[model samples]
Target: MAIWYTADTHFGHENIIPFSGRPFRSASHMDSALIENMWKVVKPEDTLWIVGDFAFGPAAKDMNWLEMIFGQLPGAEKHLVVGNHDGELSQLLPWDSVSQLTEVEDNGKCNVLCHYPMITWSGARKGALQIFGHVHNNWFGSRNAVNAGVDVWDYMPVTLADIERRARKLPINKHWTDVEQRTAAE
Candidate 1:
């Protein structure tokens, strides 16, 4: 089964549309599109990891509404790296796992997952990749730290290969040199 990752969905937050410059006309429209986009690539057998900010606004506070949205998530196993917006109700969803930070081994490579991007992470000096969200469209992330937010990734979950490919083309993080050994290229 493949592993998929995404973050900062802000599913029910109406204000996010205007604030983040999202293309949706309304929150409902954005939610539907996000779900559709996820199902397009994330199959039932794949594992889906949402780094943070699963939902927000009035809808998120309702147990039934949260359940409805949680039920619609397309994945055999869902994991949540709890974000600031992920309230107690969001955490109550039957997730496979939930935490503020965790390490995942995808394609034999270690990936440090968190709600917010970090200047340094576990295994940073050993080639581990850090995937995070929360900044939304303001940043696209650096070489070693990649943004997995939907706003930057066409509002869809991405695979590890996708993240790695993007990391290679992006500029290296300035703080990378401070935490890790300097490479000849840098």
Candidate 2:
């Protein structure tokens, strides 16, 4: 099955519209768009990984609302990386897996998933790519680490290939040299 990654949906948070300069008229409008966009790319046989901030606001506290959102997710298996906004109830949504930080192997590479972007992650020197959210649209992210947040993307889940392509175009992290030891291959 194909794997997809996304984060910072902020599904029920109304303030996100203005805060993130989202074009949605309302929370309902934003939510619908998010779901529709996800369905367009994610499929029943694929895996969906929400790196962080699945939902927020009062609606997120409602189990029925959360269940409805969870039920509508398009994927045979779903995983959560657990953001700051993900409460205990959000964590109880029957995800295939949930963690504060975890490593996933995709396309013969290890992807380090977390809610907050890190200056460095496990296997940073070994070529592991770090995927994260939480910062919203503040930055586009560095080469080895990328933001999978919906705010960075066009409000949809993205595949590893999409991430890799973007990573290639983006500049290397300024801290790259500071964290990763250089080899004298040059």
Candidate lDDT scores, in order, read 0.95, 0.92
Sliding window of 10 residues with minimal summed lDDT for model 1: 174-183
Per residue, candidate 1 scores C-alpha lDDT tens digits across 1-186 of: 999999999889999999999999999999999999999999999999999999999999999998999899998999999999999999999999999999999999998999999999988877899999999999999988999999999999999999999999999898777767677996
Best by lDDT: 1
TM-score on alpha carbons, each prediction = 0.96, 0.95
The CA lDDT at 75 in model 1 is: 89
lDDT (10s digit) by residue, model 2, range 28-141:
899999999999999899999999999999999998899999888899999999999998888999999999999999999988999998989988877788999999999879
Error of 2 at 3 (Å): 0.2
Off by over 4 Å in 1: 181-186
